[model samples]
Structure formats: C-alpha cells, structure tokens
Target chain A: MERSIRSYSPKDTHKIGRRIGTKAQSGDVLLLVGDLGAGKTTLTQGILWGLGGTEYARSPTFVLVNEYPARLTLYHMDLYRLNSIEEIEDLGLDDYLYGNDLCVVEWADKAPGYFPVNHAVVQLEVIDDQTRRVTVSSETAHLDRLVMAIAGGADE
Target chain B: MSDQDIALAIDTSTRYAVVGVSRDGQSIAELSWRSDRNHSVELVPAIQRTLAQAHVSIEDITVIHIAIGPGAFSALRVGMSTAMAMATGRDIPIITIGTLEIEVHPYLDLGQDVTAIIGAGRTRLYIGTFKREDSLSNGHVYLEDRDKFLENLPVDSIFCGEAVAELRSELIGRLGPDYKIVSAPPPTRSASVMAEIGHAKLKSGDTTDLADIEPIYLRSSQVASAARRWPNTKTE
Candidate 1:
C-alpha cells in the first residue's frame, strides 16, 4: 500500500513523520529518498519525537549513523556521503537493519539493494518553496496499517 | 614452552567473534564471544587476551589463519586487516579460509551433504553446499532467500552454522525429521578448525600473499531483482 501526504511547511512534515513513527515497530526500516533541503531531517526529527526521544535527531551524513534511545531504539542513518555500494556494504548495517530496533535511513536510494526485504520507503518531492509531497510505500501489513493511521489522522 | 610453530586464527565473520592460538595443530587457547557490532574494538583485545592465555607473544606466531568471509562486511574486514598486519609485521605466512568452510568442517565427517548458512540481514542467508566426498570442490557461497534455501535442501543433508538456530522451525517444517541441523551446544570452535586447516596448508607450503587476499562478499543480486518487482511508487 502507498499513501501521499502534502506538507505545507516543515512543521507539517514533522507531524506526518510523528504519526508514522508512533506506529513504527521493532525491526521496521524507513528509507527516506529526497534531495538535500527537502525536509528529510525535519521528518526524522518528528519521528524521534514520536518515539519518545528527548534529543533532536541530526543528519547522519558525516558520522554515517546515530543511535537514539526511546520507546524503541532508533538508528538514524544517512548515505549521502558514501561514494559506492562497497562502502555502504562495509557500513555493517545488517545488525541495525535486522536487529531489534527501528532504522530510518536518509538518502537510502544510494544503495537500494542493501536494505532488508521488508521495508517502507518514504519519497519526498519538493513542490514549491513551502510545500512538499511525502509518499510512503510498502507491501507489508505493518506498513498498510501505518498508511491507514496516517490517512485517518489517528494521532494516538 | 615447547619450540613448535605457533598459529593464530581469527574469525570475526559473524556476530560471534573467535580468536585462537594453536601449537602444531593442537589448540592451546581459544576465546569466542558474541560481539555487539563492535568487532573492530573487541577483536584486537580478544587476540591479545587469547595470546596471553596461551602464554605466547605476537613474535612467536609463525602462521596466521583468517576466515575470509561471505559474512558481515565490516566484521570480516576487521579480522582480515588484523591478520594482514600481524602477518606482515612478523613476515609470516597467512592462510585465508572461507567462513563457510570453517562452519562445515566439523560436520564433514558425517559423510552427508552439508549446507552452511550465515544470516544475511532479514529473511535472507549466505549459503554454501558441501558434499562430504568432495567438500573442497563445492564451497562456492551465494546469497538466497531463507525459505528458498530451506525448501531446496536435499533429504538427509546436514545443515549447520549461525543461521541454523533462527531457521530451526522452518527447517523442521520444510524437511521433516529427515534432516539434521547442527548448532553450538557442543560448540565446534571455528577458529580452532581454521588453525588446523592452516597448519595442514602450511605443511604443504600453501599460503596466500598479503597483498592479494580479500573478503568474499556475496553480492545481493537476488534481493535487487526482488526489489525491482515492487510496484512503481514514483509520482509525477
């Protein structure tokens, strides 16, 4: 199933991400594909907030990954600085991708094949200076319920 | 201490990292533990501790045996680089063995076809098939879906490796009672096995060049093709 939500501002994007994050489970992977300045970090910050994280989630483009403690541990990753698939493979992401935690990856398109079989992909497209389109797509039932919750505006 | 050649074996191919020291094909000291994705940090210390336990220093090491992986990429690199550095510093021979080979070595004596598996992220595995009679010729490793690999197992074949525990029920469901899944209760220390193999190879003057060794990372072509089958989610 797939769902698209339009964000009029960064706050709107964060709200949408919060909804998705609240419904995220252990071992859930959220792949974020978008150009720079497309509010990827904004969405992830909202996710961290929803997961009960106190600190802000920063872009992991340089350090590669950041771990945050919350209701469920969150592994935030970024592939923007990686130059090749070999580098990504060497990141040793299997443990985080398959472990008992939640992973949200920015610039995941850099190595699409490296992710697990079951995962949700969130694509952000810039519509204007103040608007963006966020699309979440996945075939698993977990993601289907997540899309439903987002579409229904179920904030609990 | 006797004046025998000492061999150091390191295997950080999976979550379990093992380091062992051997004197003429006999294990003197070995340490294996589950690393919390900190192989780079844990590996060198584990080696030092293992060598200390064996009452041997790094200079006494004459041969190094390392498991070149079809396993975790960074874990394999940690083991590989450490082995390479030690071998180069001592001007000793290094024997590179495949991870799957070490996994299946303990089970080869059963005289049955053995399949060695290493978990590759979610619901996928790195597997290699070994025929008992000609195990060396059939050690080609590849990646496959977990269910797919289990479904294709021949009757009465032995399945072994780190992945066996997680896939136990699936294997029983698919293959019934005819199959055997070997696990670590009677743990076959892989590093010890590597040391023995390295000893045999050293006796025959078979050693890998320090500059030429590389980890055997099986690519994810199968997963890539499966990803392509997903419905196009791109919007205009």
Candidate 2:
C-alpha cells in the first residue's frame, strides 16, 4: 500500500511523524529515506517523543544506532557512512533487527538486503525549501493505517 | 633467553593495535592502545616499545606472528604488510593465526562447547565452534554462518569472543538459563595469548611461508567504484 502526503512546514512534518509513532507497535521496522537535512532527524525526534520517550532522539550518524526506552523500545540507526553489506553485518545488527522493538533506519539504502518484507518505507523528498512530499509505502496492511493516520491527522 | 626463541606478534584487527614479545614460550612484554582508525601511526611505535621492553632488538626476532583477520579491512592490511616487511630477508619465519581463534583459545577447557563470534558488519557474523580434545589440547575449530551457527548450537554451550557483548542478551534469551556467555579479554591480552600459540607453533616447526601469508577473511570485500556515466575522455 502507498500514501503520499505533503508537509509545508516543519510543524506539519512533526505532526505526521507523531501520528505514526502513536500508532507504532512492537516489531515495526520503519525505513526513512531522504536527502541530507530533509527532516529525517526531526521526524525521528517527533516519533520518539510521541512514543512517550523522555529523552530527545538524535541522529545516530557517528554511533550507527541508538536505543530509546519509551512505551516501546526504539532502535534508531543511521547508515550514511555505511557502504557495504559487510560493514552492516559486522555491526551485529541482527541482534536488534529481529527483536521485538520499533526500529527506524535512516539511509536504509545502505543495507537494502537486510530489511524484512513486512517493513514500511517513508520516502521524503524536498519539494521546496520548506516543503516536503513524503510517500509512505508498506507491504504489511497495518502500515497502511499508519500512513492514513499520518495523512489525516496532520490536517486536523 | 636465546635470540632464536624471541617471537614478536602484532594484532591490529578490531579497534586495538597490540604488540607482544615472547621468549622461550613465555610472554616478556606487551603494549597496546585503542587505534580508532590510527593503525598505521600507532602500530609501528607500539611494536618498537614492546620489543624494547622485552630487551630484544628487531634483528634478534626469529618469528613474526600476526592475527590475520576476519577483521577491519584497513587494519588487517596494515598488520600483514607490516609483518611481511619486518620479516623480509631476515630469515625470520612468519606464522599466521585466525583472529577468531585467538578470541576462542582462552576458553577451550571450560568443559563446555564454545561458540566464538566476531562482527562481520551487515547483519552477519563470522562465527566458529570448538570442542576441546581429550588431552586438554585446543579444540577443533570450524567457522559457521550466523543463522546456522545459532541453529546448531549444542546445549550448555559457552559463547565468547569479540562480538559477544552486543549479543549477550539475545544469546541468553535464545539459549535459555542453562547457557553461559562471557566476553573475551581485550586485544592486548589476546595478542599475548596468540604469541604463546605462535611460540608453540615455532617449536613444532609449524609455520607459513612469508610470501604466501594472507588474512583469514571468510567474506570478500564488498566495495566497488560506481559505474562510469560519461564517455572516455581520450579519443582513439
């Protein structure tokens, strides 16, 4: 399933992220794909906060991944500098990838082979300086509801 | 100690740049530091300090032992090239050991089957299993893939090595309360253990040809340059 939503400002983006986070459950792998500074980190922060996390979510570019404890555990990973399947495998990612946590991966293209079939992907494109067009697609049916919630909730 | 009994060993795999010197099967000196991407700068100096501390000169060294990797690519290259260069025309033998085995050796006699794993960086691992010999000699080692490694694990097995810290919870959860998990010592300690192994190999005349040595990389590198989009700049 696929849903395309537009956000004219950072607030709009955060609202969309919050809605998805609110609906997120265990064993959800969320792939966020976008260019640099396309609000990936901001959306992640919004999602984490919306999930009732006390600490702020930061881009895990240098550390590779960061874990957050909320109503659901969030595993946030950034793969910008990772270019190889070997590099990704050596990271011991399978220990978390298969676990019952909410995983959000940035630059999910770096290790495209590892993402499971039931995951959702959000492609955020910079339509203008402040506007972004996010296309949410997933093979799992529940993620369609997530996309719907994000699209509909943001307008309210 | 005789000059011929001095063995110098270096391991740059993983994040540690470690050097060890042993004489007559006994560890004499060791030095290591977290290289954190500074392998070339830190390794030679660390080796120099370790040899000096051991009261042995480079010219007196009879064997060069290296932990040829299933490790970081650049670090493994640095260690192999350095060891080869140090042994060139010096009549010194160079012996190589797998990095995973180095991590697995210390726990062989714990009376349990052992699973040693090192990170291979994707969602994969370079894993090996060992069963101690009846004479208390080191176990036979076999490298296995992560999924298969997990599937075929023996009951009451002990999981150890460089990658275990990240998987401690998962392994315990999977194997239940009966299994044991322990972290191996840092690279400096493992390099010393490797030196002892190399010394044994030296006494037994088990060694590698200096020219034929290579790192024990089970997986090939995955890097490739992007395809060209423009036509050739030079015309025929």
Candidate 3:
C-alpha cells in the first residue's frame, strides 16, 4: 500500500533516499513526484551517491535523461518539460526502461500512460522550510523492502 | 593448431542466430538456434553449450568474432556488448564484420554486384549494397532505405539475404529485366560463414581493437537531439 516517513533536515532526506538506492536492483522503476524546490533533486543525488555513481547528479530536466556509470547503470529521467505522449514515446524510453538497471523519473505525472504496470512511487511534500513528508507506495512486494530500507537502515 | 588456438564467433544480427567455433580455417562446431526476440537470454547459454559440445573451454578461445551490425539495434547491442566483454576479459583479439557482409559473402565472387537486405521492421528493410569486387577489398556496405534502394537498383546486380524470401514478390514487382533477384537458399549457415571469415582475418592479422567496436545503426535514436531542441525552457 503506502508508507510515510518524515525528514527533519536535508541530511535525513538524503539518508532515506540513499537507503533505497542501495537496495535498488535491476528493473526497478522509481517515480518521484513533488513540486518545485521540494528536494526531489537532492533525494536523487543521494540515490546516485548510494549507487556508487561517480558523476555529480545533475537535473535531467532539459535533456530528459542522464546516464551515469555505476555498479549498475543509473538512468535518471525528468518528464517535466516533455509536452506530449508522442514526444515521450519518440524518445524510445523502453530501451532504458526495460534495461537491466535502475531508472529514476522525476515529474512522472506528465507521462503516466507509458509507465510500467508495476512501479514504486514516492511523493514528497514540503511541511516547512526545513521539513518534508515522503510517502512511498507500490502494488508489488519488492517495494516493501525498499520502503523498509528507507525507514530503517540499509544494513537491516 | 589445437583447441588452444580456437576462435569463437557469435552473430545475432538477424532473427536467425548462430554460435560457432573454428580452428585454422576449419569449423569445429556450428550451433544454430531459433529466437523470436530473446537474444539476451539465449545467447550466453548457447555459447556455453556450443563450446562444451566442441570440447573447448572459454580459456581456449584465442579470438572473439562478432557481427557489429546494421540490423536491429537491441539485438546488435546484445551481440556486440557480449562479445566485447568476453574478448576484454581474456585479452583475446576480436574480428568485427557487418551483418550484411555475412549475407553477401557466399555470393561475393559470383561476378555480380550484391545487395543484402534484412527486415528492419514493418514496411522497412535494412538494405546494404556492395560491389563484390569492392567487398573483397576495402569493404564498404551502404545502408539505404528499402524503397530508395529498389528504385535505384543497378543492372546485373544479385539480391540476396535472409529476408529475400519474404521480399521476393516485392523485388520482382519493382525490378526490370536486367536485375536478378536471387533469394538466399534455405539452411542459413551464417554463423559458419562468420567463423570462416573470422579465421581468415585472424591469420591475416586484421583483428579489430576491442575498444573501437560499435554497432552500425543507420537511424539515429534521436533522444539526445530531441532534448537539445528546447534548451531555454524553465524546467524543475
């Protein structure tokens, strides 16, 4: 169903994201949803850090996708500026989506029709200047471990 | 000279797939399998079983040959990436050939120009034409649109490839009296042909740098270019 976690600071938010990143595996699709300046990019940076990615996690807003060399390839996509479904399909996203790596998409609400039937969604809300409430949900059991990893620690 | 000097060839350039082993210009084992679109899953196991049947281990492979293709992009990637990994790990030499070249090889010395065509997708074909004389020398395969290629067919050229059968009616309909449409004969032994070519190349020291191997895709993926089209947009 859904699980909620509260982060009092940026570090706490990063820690949670990093935990999920460490636990991520091939064919895992992460849907990040939030408003502007809602710490989405910061959470993604933490995810990349945990994945052993060497490059700085840059916003893929204009480019749509940023690929990083990691223990497993990291495909970070931003659907904020993608206007139409045809444009999104023309990108041939299946090559990266079905690939044997982790795929993280920001502002995924723009292209909901093309999303896989099973995926994990993370919703971030700004409670205050320094606080954020994150909710994670999925239909599959694999998401339980990811949410648990984010709530507890990566070790357990 | 022996099992230690054996070479392995893998081709997933088309729907029909093959894994073969050769030594000193002689094919030791040629394994053919059917795949709809599961190259990634079937390829490794096919290699393992084929090598085992040939009584050769991965350690005995001295060279890895693959078809760096102008075929299906995903299939070509699976073949090239796998071959590169295998060659890199063992420090073995690699020989790269075009997928169309494999189809054109059997008819290379037939004293006629040849155009190899493979199904790219619905209503489109990956067609490459080569002058047999030129193919034997500084090989240059040209990828062109199917309709354009048919309209510009040269006189006395022989057309052949795995997809030739399916396109036979279309070819006959488009061609004139001077052109000859020769559909590729059944029992496609493309993998064997690949191994033979590879062995010949290896003896002549025409191996490819493993780092420089890449698939020849005629159509662009367009993701990067599309993204760059709107750089001034405010996105967060």
Candidate 4:
C-alpha cells in the first residue's frame, strides 16, 4: 500500500513522520529518499519524537549511523557518503535492519537493491522553497497500518 | 616451553572484539569488549594489550587462532586479516575456527543435538547443528529464517549462542516445553573458550594454510559478490 501527502511546511512533514513512527514496530525499516535539504533529518526528528525520544535526532552523514533509544530503538543511518553497494554492505546493516529495532535510512536510493524486501520507502520531492510531496510506499502488508495511520492523520 | 606453546586467539565475529593469550592450553590473559563497528581500529591495540597483560611478546607467540564467521562481514575481515598478517609476519601456523563452532563448544557435553545461532539480521539466523558425538566438525552451519528454524526444530534440541536472548520468548512460544534453550554467557567472556578450542586444534595439527584461509561469510551470493567488489576498501 502507498500514501501521498503534501506538506506546505517543515512542521507538517514532521507531523507526518511522527504519525508513521507512532505505529512502527520493531524490525520496521523506513528508507528515506530525497535530495539535500528535503527534510529527511527533520522528518526523522519527528519520528524520534513520536517514538518518545527526547534527544534531537541529527544527520548521521559522517558518523554513518546514530542510535537513539525510544519505545523501540531507532537506528538512524545516512548513506550520503557511501557511494557504492559494498560501502553500504560493510556497514553491517543486517543487525539493525533485521534486529528488533526501527531502522530509518537516509539516502537509501544510493543502493536501491541492497535493503531487505520488506521495507517502507519514504520519498520526498521538493515543490518549492517551503512545500514538498511525501510519498510512502511498500509492497508488503507489513506497513499497511502505518500507511493507513499516515493517511488518516494527513486528513486531520 | 618452546615458542610453539604460546597461542593467541582473535574473534571479532560479532559486536564483541575478543582477544586471548594462552600458554600450553592454559589462559594467560584475555580481553573482550563491545566494539560497535570499530574492529579495524580496536583489534590491533587489543592484541597488543592482551599480549602485554599476559607478559608475552608478540614474537614469542607461535600460533594464531581466529574465528572465521557467519557474522558481521567487516568485523570478521578485521579479525581474519589481522590473524593472517600476524601469522604471515611470524611465519607461524594460523588456525581458523567457525564462529558457530566456538559458540557451540561449551554445550557439547549435554549429549543432545545442539543448534548454535548467530543473528543474521531481519529475524534470520546463521545456525550450526552439532551432533554431540561430532561437535568439532564445521560442516553444518547454515542460514535460516528464525521462525521456520524454531518450528522445525527436533524434540529435545538444545539451542545456544548470542542470538538466544532475543529469541527466548519466540523459542518458548513456538516449541512449547519440548525444546531446551541455554543462553551462553556474554560472548566477550568466552574468549578463553575460543582460546581453548584453538589450543585443541593446534595440538591436533588442524592449522589453516596462510595463503588459502578466508573469512567464512555465509551470506547469500548477491550480498557476497557485492562485498567481493570492494574487498580492498576500508569499512570505516
């Protein structure tokens, strides 16, 4: 299932992320695909907030991954610096992606084929300086409730 | 005792980077710590520290033993290459033991089939089935989905390893009271166990050829071949 919503401001985007995060389960993976400044980190911050994380979530670009404790542990990964599939593979991603945690990957399009089959892809497209279109899609029903939650929240 | 009596064991196959120094099958010193993903940076210094603590010079170490893995890809490489390089530099024999074998070693006395598991990310596991009589063999480790593996487990099968804690509820729920699950102590504390296994292999002449030994990465071919593409690239 898939859902798309338009965010007229960064705050709106964060709210959408929070909605998704609240419904996330352990072992859930959210792949964020967007250009620079497309609010990936902002959305992640909102997701972290939704998951009951108090510390601010930052871009783990140089560090590659940053772990935040929440209702379910959040493993936030940034692949902007990794240029190839091998670089991503060396991240030992299986543990986070497969373990009992919620993993959110930034720049996930860097290796489209590298992630597991069951994951939700969150794509963001900038419409203007302050507007963006966020699309969440997944083939498996693993993320159906999350998609529904986001869709339901967007209507409010 | 001759130089051949000192053994160094390295296992960076999981979150823990473990180093142990043993002399004549007895442990002299050992260190194990959660390394996150810093194995490449942490392993050499760990080796130095363990050797220093044991009062054994690196040059006096005659054998190197490594846990080749069905584990973290880069972590396993860090341990394997360090062991290989040290062995090559010293012109000593290097013995490679399967990580699962080391994991299953402490449970072989139960006289039951033991299934040792290492988490393979995403509710999948790298599992090794060891018949009590032939616990030393390395031919049985394979990857399987965790739920399926538990559902099909034989009655009275004993399970152990780092992944056991996470699977305890599931194992008990699915298999009911017919199965047994033994949680091993934290892996870092088991470096001495790895050293003992290495020592036994050393005494039995089960050393690996320096030129042919490679890390045992039991991933699917797609991921395996992709990893092979950048074999020379440093992970960190």
Candidate 5:
C-alpha cells in the first residue's frame, strides 16, 4: 500500500474514523496501532459509524472483541487483551478476518501476525495534549487509496 | 414492466409486517402485524402468506419492495437482506423505502417540516421530512445520538413517528410549534409503496444494480462515520 501520514487532533480522529467506516465494505480488516489514549478506539468509533453500525463502538479492552451485526457486521477487536499469539486463535480471529464483514482490530501489535502486513494499519501518535499524528500503512494499493481518503488527502 | 404483476414488499424497520402486494403502483393486498417480537421469524412467512392470499407466485413478482429502516437496525437488515437475496435469485429489482417515510404518509396532519422519526437506541432518532399537505419526503436522515439532537435540529422541524409517544412532551417543550406532535402508524415496510417508488424509478430509469444496492444506514459503522460525530478538526 502507498504510505501516507496526516496530523489531527483527537477530536478529528472520529471524523477520520467515520470516513473509513462509510467506505468500509464487507470483508475489510483494519489493523490499528497506537499508544494508549492515542485515539485508536475513538477512530474506531468513527469507523463503526461509517460502516452503518448503530450501537456505540467502545474499547474492547475487557472483551477481546465485540461483534455488532449491522448493514455489515462490525467486529471490533482489541488485541491488548491477549497475552500472546497462541491466544489469538481461540478468539477465532481468522474467522472474522476473512469473513463477509468488516473488522477493526485495535492494539493489533500485541497479537503479532500477518495482520500487520495483510491489512491497513493506522498508526496514531499523541504529539501533545491536543494533537495526534497518524501514519497509515498497508501492503495492498487498495488500502493506500483508503488511507489517503481517511487522512484527508494529498498533504496528509 | 409487466402489467398486473405481483411484488413482495417487506418492512422490518420496526416490530410489524408492513408487507403487501402491488400491481402497477396499486395495492392488491397489504398485511401488517403488531408485536415486539423478532421480525426474523415472522417477515418471510408474512410475505409468503400475503402472496398466497393474493394468489400470486414468485414468478409473478416483478419487483421487491423492502423497507429500509430508520427503525431497529437488525430488523431492517433482516427484512431488507432477505428480500434482497430473494430478488437477486429471481432476477427482480429491489426498492428501498424509509421507515419515517411510511410513518409520515398522506394520512397525518403534519406540518411542512414534520420530523418523522424512529427511535435509534440510546434516545437518538432517525428522521424523515414531510409537508403538512399529506405527503412524505423522498428519504430519511439520522438524528445521530440524542445528545446531539437538540444541538442540531434542521430548524422548523415537527416531530412524529413511534419515538414521539415517549419523547413527545420534552421535544415539544423544547422546539415548540416547530414540533407538531401527530399520531402516526407504527413504522412498517409498505411493499405496495415500495412498488410505486420502484416502478416510478424504473420508468425513469433510476434503478441500481443489486451488488450496488445497500441499506441506507445513516451512519457508518466504520471509522469514517465516526468522523461525522467527532469534533471537526480546525485546520491551523
């Protein structure tokens, strides 16, 4: 995927998230990487909204994943709950990863696998109390267009 | 484009059958059920029964009218999707109608800006516009989360729909004459109406491909929709 970076405030993350969700179709996997409080879940919230999810999308920290069946079921997963790769399989990550629905995995780095390269990875950084810097990555060119669209284009 | 053809319309936006038959934009048979039960089990059977009652078969159906919801998300999905799949197999066209549009139909004493809304879990509403003259808007818009409703109403808006019964007084007190409270039929999919809309669009050459068709879920469940709710970022 083509690499792109964009800077946004935590508040702006949701709008970016919404854009992704709106365009997200069934069978799309989004891997999100960011430090704590970096707005990963906030962006995911926007994604859920874009994907036509009705229920609120929250951090799945306690639960590894929360499945919301909507126009397209949104599987919100937080890998932070998993201790290791061995535990990922038990959660049926693969079932949803390639399923006929959209999936967003927060803190995906904690699980470690093809997830890093096979899908779009949005890296968000907390630059200051009110600022966030994002670097979006992916191996597929399709994702580059998605990232560019989500990050708000050209300069971003 | 067949005359006197049968059509299957399904409305799962709320807890009702809102199903029926139509021939060239005319209602032949219409059936609805009132229960807070799962529409999943009931929608299909109701459709089949309606067809049987009308003495129509799948082959007789020229179109499928599915109520696209501003109601329960899951219910609308079930109804729309079921009809969508069936229509695809039969090679028929699928038409989508909004829940609020059905609610604010020609029967109500609505104002020009009638807010035909459906409850969106967590006190939010899905809205459709209407004219006091007894006709509804072409489509519906979401009120998003309720916390934002009062903050961003479309102005001169009157509230209607299943959500009105509970939230009426509060909304009226807040918005005033802008909020004309009116009794509306519980939201249901009107297959017959869908036929009218579909037939009109088809005649005007306004239909979309099945694969291109999707539910009009107002917000994205994806990160993108989240952006709409997120505080818009100020560019420096």
Candidate 6:
C-alpha cells in the first residue's frame, strides 16, 4: 500500500521516474508531492520519458496540463494554483485520468480533496539541498512491487 | 476538418475570465475577479488549474476554441491572443466564437423570433439576427450593421442586447411584441455555443486560417464598456 525511496541527486531521482514510467498503465494516476524545487519535476520528466519516449515533460504549471501523444498519451498536471475542488471538474480532468492516458499530478496536496482514490501518491522529503526521500502509496500489488524495485534500485 | 479534435474554450472576455471550458455544454468553469486587470496573472494558472482539475493537460486540448469580443478589449484580447499565441506556437488549429452570441444566448427563444445587438453609438447599432439553423441546434447570428440587421430581421424578432432597452420604445412601437427586449448573462459568449456554430462551419469546410480568426467586434466600440455595448459585463 505504501513504499518509500531516497535519491541523492537528479540522476538518482530520475531512476525513480524510470521505474514508474516502465510500470505505468493507461488508467494509472500518479500524484507527486514535494516542496518547491524538490526534483518533482525532474522525476516527472523521467517518468514521462520512460512511459512514452517523450523528451519534454516539464512542470506544466503555467501551461496547466501538457499531453504527449507517444506510445501512450501522458498527461502531466501541476496543481499549484488550484482554487476549489470544482476547479478540477471544470477542466474535465478526470476524463484523462480515467481514460487511456497516464496522469502525473504535481502539487496535488494543494487541492487535497480532488485526488482519485486508487492513485499512487509520491511524497518527496528533502534531507538536504542535494538529498531527498520519496514515498509511494498504492493498493495494487503490481505497482507495490514496481515501487519497491525502483526504490531499491535507486542508489541515492 | 475530418477529425475529432480536443476542443479548447478560453473565456477571459470579462472581469470573470474562463481559461478553458469543457467540451460539455452544462456548467462553465470561470476565472472570477473583481477590479484588477489580472488576466495576465490569472489566465495561465487558471488554465493549469482547470486542466489539472479535469485531469487533462494542454496536450489533450487539440483544437483551440476561444471567445472573440463583445467584452473588454483586454479580457477579450486575452482569450484570442492566448489562443492565437498557442496555436501559433503549437501549430494547432483555432476555432473562433461570436462573443455577442454567447452573451445573448440565455435570453434567446426558439419559439419566438430574436434580434441580438451590442450597442454602437447614438441610434446606430451592431446588430445580428439568430435565424433557426435547425430544430435541435441553436440559431445563427449575423453580426453586422443595423440596417443590414433590420433588413434580415426574422419574423417576430424579439430584441435583447446592450442597447435593446434603450431603443425599446422605437423597436416595440415598430415591431410590437413580435420584437421585444430581454436580458442576458455576462459570461454568455460560451465556447459551447461557439462549438455548435463553429462545428457547422468547420464541417462544411468553412474554417478560417488560425491567423485569420480574429475577434468579432459587433461595432466600432463607443466610450462605453462591453456591459454597455453587449452584456459581457454586469447590467447597469
């Protein structure tokens, strides 16, 4: 249900991303939590790249959500500016999360109420400017193993 | 033209701005504000928030549909400018909606004839008629000058817009109950309505170039605001 990870640098963070990307599914919802510049965006880039061979998987904060049409459509969402829970429904967001696309949400904690129930929650805790601890939460056994593998493989 | 696109609707045409409305025709997701001209600050965040809220992102938004005018020059400029800018940068096709029509829609009736107008100046007006496009679909709007509008007025045209009440006596005395006046909501220029109209046009291969799709300024604006000209703002 819940697993944890640690990363020493950007490359270590990306290893966490690669495992998630390799294991992501069409209806999977990945909720990333971290403070400002905790390498959440860096992890996202790795996940998006691994999932769909995409080269661009930025924060998508100012631009809202960015979609890449590759092997599987990857939806990247940054919720740093969200106001109300209705803001989620207004944009028709769940359509993608429930559809045939992989969803990654940043600052998902800001809204607190809108995250789907079965989503994988990634919590990044900064130990120093260069070191970070990441935790994953999910119910599916497959994903639990994937998270374990990635967290174990990460040589932070 | 032969594709099902990710239709986008941005409505920053008022004090209350809408970054990107849903493909659905029901409730709208609006970016509300008071006195600040904060579209620059609110727009992208609103878009991102709305997109994340819906669980989709900008990439899911294939067709950039936006409101053009019948609103504040700045707010109106926001949706169009942002849409055009995105279309240009992303190489996506753009869909333009009539700002006045969206505003006047809540007041329109299929059973009764209707005339939609945003104010021009003096007695002259920026008038457009909503002739029945179909039984199920909303009517069409011919955004043009008053004389042309008056000439094409559908039988029993009920007038409602910014200055319709101002011309109420003249219009009523002239057209009677057949052409009455009504009030409309400010966020009326919905991307949903535009999607309906634009769909027909788009299906018939009637789309304009992304660069050519500009605002539909019903008339050369007077010193008054869109609320005065159209109902894109609150009623005075």
lDDT of the candidates, in the order given: 0.82, 0.75, 0.75, 0.82, 0.67, 0.63
Question: How high is each candidate's TM-score?
Answer: 0.87, 0.57, 0.58, 0.70, 0.54, 0.42
Q: Tell me the docking grade of candidate 2.
A: incorrect
- lDDT for each residue of candidate 2 in B32-61, tens digit (9 for 90 to 100): 777866898888888889888988888889
**Candidate 4 clashing pairs?**
A98-B122
Residue-by-residue lDDT tens digits, candidate 5, B138-185: 444654545466566657655667777776667777877655576554
Local accuracy of candidate 3 as per-residue lDDT tens digits, B157-232: 7888877887678778777555577755533446778877887788788998876787775542233344345333
> How well is each residue in B1-236 modelled by candidate 4, as lDDT tens digits?
46457889999998877899988778899999999679989999999999999999988998988898888777888899888889988898998888988888878888888888777777678888888777477348887777678778755668888888877888888878775888555562377787788888888888889888977655654455554554333221
Q: Candidate 5, residue A150: CA error in Å?
A: 40
Q: For residues A67-110, could you state the per-residue lDDT of candidate 1 as single tens digits? A: 99998899999977776665666677776887779999987775
Clashes of 1: 0
Model 3 stretches with alpha carbons more than 4 Å out: A1-156, B1-4, B137-140, B176-179, B185-189, B220-236
Q: What lDDT does candidate 3 reach at residue A155?
A: 28
What's the TM-score of chain B for every model shown? 0.89, 0.81, 0.85, 0.88, 0.76, 0.62
> In candidate 3, which residue pairs clash?
none
Candidate 3 has what TM-score?
Answer: 0.58
The C-alpha stretches of model 6 lying farther than 4 A from their native spots are A1-156, B1-4, B14-16, B24-36, B104-112, B119-126, B132-155, B161-180, B183-185, B217-236
lDDT of 6 by residue, B121-230 (tens): 22245555665443323545433445555555556666676556555666666666555566443333444565555555555665559758766543222212322332
| Winner by TM-score | 1
Question: By TM-score, is 3 or 4 better?
Answer: 4
* Ranked by DockQ, top first: 1, 4, 2, 3, 5, 6
